[model samples]
Target: MEQSDFYELNDGAKLPAIGLGTVNIQGAKGVNSVLTAIDAGYRLIDTSTNYMNEGMVGEAIRRSTVPREELIISSKLPGAAHDYDKAITMIQESLYRLGIDYFDKYLIHWPLPMQGKYVEAWQALIDAQKFGLIKTIGVSNFLEEHLEKIIDKTGVTPATNQIERHPYFNNNEVVETNKKLGILTEAWSPFGREINDVIEHETIAKIAKKYDKTPTQVIIRWNLQNDVMPIVKSSSLKHQKANLNVFNFELTQEDIQTIDLLDKGEPGRVEGQHPNEYEEFG
Candidate 1:
């Protein structure tokens, strides 16, 4: 995207359509990986307390030739820090670790609805935004109820909802819900994380062959075409560049439908945890 791409969030903030995900990337290698993404034209970079690499992400920001204001940096609050006081501290701590003044966006990593603290956490995020600690605030892994709970209690809708989405599990229900709410849906594991199960699918392979592109490119494009921002992770520079090169081709509506048809519902979830029951201790 030479002109670069952006999406107008519900909160009237602009966010890049495609972003780099820093999951396993850590330490010096992680720093280099994030730097590579910045150098490769990724304007948005996603990090999280759960990911445990805010320091490296911060270092990459320092080393990048791109101006700090030009890049949109995001991080998340951990499950352990859902309390009002703890959530506020974690937001400040993330900034301290990143050595940045403020985050472009920040999210609650999980709803942890069972604890009934997510709404309370949402209140903390609102306070942080008012304090100018973060430009935008949202949540991850939130189902419909989780989303409504916060919005009902606080009257603040999240700007985005990051979730596990791929061909194997389209999660269209959540996607459409986000759509109606005017919330941008971000796909975390756009490639299914397990890799082979998604990219190697017969349907995706056929479309890839038709476009003369790898299944990876097709997936990223699929996310864009579906109005979903994809946060993809790649350690190699070549793959990072290749991931963003998807703009040249367009998938036919029929192809998009066929791909969506490949959804296996809950059976296709790659990550073992369901958002509702997941109790994150780490």
Candidate 2:
């Protein structure tokens, strides 16, 4: 299996198709997980300051032999860090934590419209990228209108948009719009938040049996087929290895359509703050 399948960003940077998400992983556990993943040939590591595990992630990176250029490290500015100065400082701090000179990608974690500073924060991101603080800049949990607002104001399209996406909430409209705008769609909770019921749905299980794969494998494969970067989280070494085992099998076009019918067109998890009620944090 290819350890590093590539996905093209709007800016033309190619990201590894799969990443190990470090949300909620912390302390020694986090450090070990990241080291283990890197040692296993995983090139992408996703973490956030809010995850509060960048220090451990940094430690793991230092302990590994992979050079900085070979790793794609992605972090985000938390909602409270939306102010320009604070956002810039937070990013620098994150780099310090990760023991890296610059991030492979940095994102506005969410658009808090009530705070009314994300546009400025977005500008900060652009400037940071220009300064080479990060190689790519993007956002997370931003819907279409929020994305359009930033593009209109700054004329800088986000390189990608990471969102809660899975079979149950495909968000194809958003994906299509992102394609039109040259932004890549990234799936944060690619397994439907461990809602294993989706895995057991008759259609999925039937297809899985046919393919000799698990329901989880089917979902990840579906994401790859749809051209979305799928971030799968796992603390267990066994499941971590299992998650990456998605490359050998292929989901047919018919299987893809069956999964497509699972879209409920509703928000699944981590939908961003409403524009009117956005809050500030630092």
Per-prediction TM-score? 0.97, 0.92
Candidate maximizing TM-score: 1
User: Where does candidate 2 stray beyond 4 Å?
Assistant: 1-3, 194-196, 267-282
Extract clashing residue pairs from model 2: 80-281
lDDT: worst 10-residue window of model 2: 267-276
- What is candidate 2's TM-score against the reference? 0.92
Candidate 2 has an lDDT of 0.83
lDDT of 2 by residue, 2-26 (tens): 5566887778898987888988899
Off by over 4 Å in 1: 1-3
The residue-by-residue lDDT of candidate 1 on 1-282, one tens digit each, is 322668889899999879899899999999998888888889899999888899999998899899999999999989899999999999999999999999999999988878879998999999999999999999999999999888999999999999989998889999999999989999989988865578888889999999999999999988899999999999999999999888888999999999999988888887566899888886
